[model samples]
Target: MTTTQRDHPSIIQADGEYLAAIATGRFYPGVLLFRSPDLTRWEQLPHPLEQVEMPESGIVLDPDLSYVDGVYHLLYGTALSASESGFADSPICHVRAPSPHGPWSPPVLLHAKGFHPSLYHESGRSYLLWSEWDHRPGRDSFGGTWAQEFYRGTRRLTGRAHLVRGGARGARLHRRAGWYYLVAGGIAVARSPHLTGPFHPDPHGALVAEGGPGCLVEGRAGEWWLTAWPEGGCALGSETVVRAVDWAGDGWPRVGDARPATGAAAPVPPGGARVPAEPGSTARADGRLPAEPELTAPADERPPAEPEPLTHTDDFDATELAFCWQSVRRPPDPGWLSLGERPGWLRLRADESPASRHRVSLLARHQHQDCEFTVLLDAQPTHFQQLAGLIHYTDHTRWHWLHLTHHEQLGRCLAVLTSDNGQLAAPADPLPWPNGPVWLRALLQHGELRFTASADGGSWTGIGPPLPVSRGFLGVCATDLTGARLVCDVDRMSLRPLSSPR
Candidate 1:
């Protein structure tokens, strides 16, 4: 029998059973903390870093939370963010706290690149095993410091990413039956006991080299098991999977699930084949290997909390900003939109869409890759050109929209896409529906994005071309090149990511 820690976390955390992944707002990546109990059910805790700094250096990722004596130390990867991303360098930052969940100290910058760190103690000094980064010029991957070593101080470890090479991502180490094992890749594997030097990368670098279904865990049997994530994160997706790992006589790790093999290992003929390691240069002397590289990646997010029902709607009984509505990419103008005026209806006083180049009215964003997302609206325009509905967008490089605007007939709709060339017809349906009280929905699965509009909130029709969903943000927006303030009172609007079956 095997035990997998998830919902019931061994550690007691501040937030509830599952954590929420609060976006860092800007490109500053956000983190989710989980309190686990005996490696089973996990609970969410308060984030280590709350407010995103001005210039985000890098994100702290693959946070492996552990306790050293009484204080909690987290080993993680440091990452940088682009300017549009809200950061300057994106180096690896480390923060220490007296408690696992705490008034944590500031980020302790570790390295320029490198990611995913694991802390280990040898003799008396403490060290880290992190994923390495490539320093070589031109190449995008390979050869880094994914080894084992001791850290003397900030960013000063006994060794680099690859004790001798560099470039490691998912590095894991453990002593089994007195034999030491190293795992990485995201799944690369090599072994040694000394914790430094030349590693004969197992022909297969990952502990579970052949990945498919099952969680591969190295429990007591001197044996392992792997659980596969069947469909991965696509279906009612985001599900936690665990399995076992098994090994062959030659010490090879393979999968129990049937999947195609990665093209790395092909059998070449002997004699005419490349010779095995020269008996002399190959050293298995002391079980000592290289260091590990680091990684950076996301949050609480009850791994499976159904997105809260969106609060804002088409009925303007109350005036206020619904928390779910977000403004990322470009800084939003507070003056153009306000909840202080009416009650539930968000007021957008005609303003220029920082995201729009020529003349377009809409402020919205795409959240994830697949799923159903929507925003309900009602707009009052003194002039004619005005619209409110589902819009898709990301950086200035991409965008599209499906909305109902006022034409000669009162409520005319149109769908438009904007690329480097210019805005072309994308999708739109004449709801003949009033600019006020219309529900707009955007359905995006995989890559195809489409917008739908409904007058009575019952029957709906597709508005345009398969709009590309570029992970955009959604919110109430108004464009007034005409200097006309468009009061678009958003009654309710919300975005959602599909989840796996409970």
Candidate 2:
């Protein structure tokens, strides 16, 4: 069966260019950006949030991108504070840039309502729509989708906030043919003549009921597509699945014919006649076929240059780190990690405890569905509880770690720890590892994780039984300890296909 792996997809077509934002936070860059000539062939663009550091224990969820009046805006939400019930108020943040690959403005707080905030522009007006949660008695955790207006220049919320639609969360807005359409939670769609009120819910109910949240994109040929994720038992992580939007005779946009997309092809807009390639022109580049361009758009709105294939592998050979390496909260401090400190090696100083959210020194890459990661660690631990090793992490809650540390009773040992929503479980006894440098390997196969270690860097020994790594895992979060300070020197860390050579 075929499936799409993109999730919480927010797409914008501006200046004849198509841009989609993928929600990736506390992993590598917070949001991953993609550009597509045709919605089918997407190319990774430079991530705008590569340097933005979200606080530890905080994560950016359901990112949205919009362009208006020459200014491009990006919005995302993060938990404002910890809550016991999993449903907590999160702050929606915004940033703007003149271009998608941008010198972006610093993040500005928009509101503390709920998650999945989206921005929409009309005629000359701007509006913010998001799910509102009510902790008050007798109200469902979610109060429903709410919206308010804002001044374009000020970027501040004005006017009273009002409920636009009821039911599911994750609100989105789009306008076509004098009618405004709203996508809620993912598949449930509604329409309204006025942007603010009186939205008409789909009588047929869910457009893609099982699908997660998504946004609408208008193709150059005037075709409307619902860029969403797979629904029902098929959904996984933040994976994305784009479905064709067909309008009923009554003018209501429906997602699909009810069935979840299983290798369903992306729909092309009418009038999307392919252009013949000319000699000496790389028109047929990156498998991206040419489509009809908006004659009304300025010349600069078209694809700039043929983008190179996005690389997930970083050798740490250069003095500077690549955008793929990210920490939980802030960008890793140079004092915590360095390439030049030890030539040909990435040195990580673990001065703070793993429990330290704000100042924790760690770096991780997003975990692919079927991949292998291997690293050589030269770690020396002096104090008990000082750990330097590999971890499969989601958030502060839900994680599994295998570390080389000094156990208070076991001296130098290798330990495994697992947490389900911050509740931890560990082996009663750690394996003795009073040896020199060791090689650690982590493999993710069908969403399960297996750990193995080698003292001589040749023969491998399994450390723990295979454990389920939740899709929520941000990636492999690791820390290093040095001297008496608990530091680990990672000579090299690599990620490759399970079938590829180690």
**lDDT values for all models:** 0.45, 0.67
Clashes of each: 116, 14
Question: Which lDDT tens digits does candidate 1 get at residues 1-502?
Answer: 1111111111212222212222222322244454433224434455565443423223334554444433455544445544343332335555656544565656666655555555654433455666555544565433355443444233344433345332244555543333345555334555443344343466644444333222234433344544333334322122234444555444445555432345453322222211112223221234232232222212223344332232223343544332323343222336555666767666666555435433333444325546567767776544445554455655344556565456566445443444433545434444455444777787777677777778777898776567555445554456555666666666666656553222
> For candidate 2, lDDT tens digit of each residue in 23-139?
765554678787777665666666777667665666677888988767778998887466556558688888877777676678889888787788877545566888886766666
On a 0 to 1 TM-score scale, where does candidate 2 land against the true structure? 0.80
Name the lDDT of candidate 2.
0.67
RMSD of each: 10.3, 10.0
